[model samples]
Target: MTAPTPGTDGPSIRPRTAQHYSVAPVLDTPEGYVAPGMPGVPVTGYDPGTPTPHRRKPRRRTGLALLLAPLAALLAGLAYGCAPLRAADSLGWLTIAQAGLVSLPLGLLGGRNRLLPPLGALLSAGALLLGQLIQQLRLVHADTTTPRTLLQHTLTSWRADLRPLDLAFYAIALTGGFLLTRRTATRT
Candidate 1:
C-alpha cells in the first residue's frame, strides 16, 4: 500500500450522511385518532376546531384536615385543663405560653392550606371552652359539689378563668402558626 498522508485515515474510515424522513400532514377526523396500545377513549390534542375545557385538580388532605382538626382541639383542651392541676399558681402568664404549645402541632399537622387558620381559631376557642367545662366537672367530682352549684359557679366565673389576655395570646399563636407553616410549605 502507498504511504498514508499526514493525519489521514485508511479507506475503511468514511464520513456519514444524515438520513431524512418525509413529513406527513396530520389529518383531523370526526372521530379522533387514538394512540396505539393506550386503553379507553382517545384523548385529543389542542385544536382550534375543539372547545377547550376548564379542569380543576381534586383537593387532597381534606380527610386529613377533618381528622386532625378535632384531634388538635381535644389536645389543646386537655393541655389547658391539665396545666393548672400540675401547678395551679405556677401557670400564670405561662398559660399564655400554652397557646403556642397548642397551636404549633395544629399548624404543623394541618399544613399551610387556606382552610387551616380559621379552623385553628375555631378549634382553639372550642378547646378553651372544653377546658373550662373539664375544670368545672373535675372540681364538682372531687369536692362533692352540687352539679347545679358548680355549673352556676363556672358560668359566672369562666371569664376570670379564661382571661381576655389569654384569648389574645391564643389568637396571636394561631396567626403565628398559620404564617410559619405557610412559609415552611413554600420553602420546600
Candidate 2:
C-alpha cells in the first residue's frame, strides 16, 4: 500500500512521501549549470548591481554663426568705403558695396562646412583683392578722377565677369551642405 522511490541503481526499499526531502543527482553537481551565486549575471558580462560607462558625441556648427560671417564682411566694406563718403565723397558707398560682396561668399562658406569655412572666407577675400586690382587698373588707364566713379564704372564694365566666381561659390556651398548633412545623420 505504498509507492517505492525511483532509483537508477535499484528500487528504494522505502516509500517516496516518507522521507523529509531529497535532491536529484543532476542538481547536486557544479558541472554544466551555474549555482546562482556566481560572479556576474547569466547573460551580461557585467553585474546588475554595478553601473556601466557612458559615451558622448561631438558638437556640430550653428546656422546663425554661418550667417554672421557675411554680415561682418558687409560691415567691413562699409567701414572702408564710407570713409570718403564721410568726407562728402561718393566713393565710400562703392567701398561699402565691395566689402559687402566679399562678406556674402565668406558667410555662405561658413554655413557649409566647419573644416572648409576658413578656406571659403579666404577665397572670398582673394576675390575682393582681384576686384581692387581691376578698379586700380581702370584709374591708371583712363586717368579716372575718383575711386567711387572708377569703382562704379569697373562694376558696369565687368558685370558678367563675376559669373565664374559665382559658380565656384555655389559649388563649395553645395558640397559643404551635403557633407554636413551626412555627418549629422551618422552621429545620430
Best by lDDT: 1
The reply for model 1, stretches above 4 Å from the true place, is 1-59, 84-86, 89-112, 140-149, 160-164, 180-188
Worst 10 residues of 1 by lDDT: 179-188
The TM-scores of all predictions, comma-separated, are 0.48, 0.31
Which run of 10 residues does model 2 get worst, by summed lDDT?
84-93
Kindly list the per-residue Cα lDDT of model 1 for residues 1-188, writing each as its tens digit: 76555467654434555756587655675576566667866556747887778676434454565576677668767766666665643433443343444455545555556766566556656766676566656655565477677777766565556666666655655565445434433212
| Index of the highest-TM-score prediction | 1
Q: RMSD in angstroms, all models?
A: 12.0, 16.5
| Model 2 ranges with Cα > 4 A deviation | 1-41, 57-143, 162-169, 176-188
What does the lDDT read for residue 140 in candidate 1? Answer: 53
lDDT of 2 by residue, 25-91 (tens): 4446655666577765276476888877777543434455456544554454344333432342233
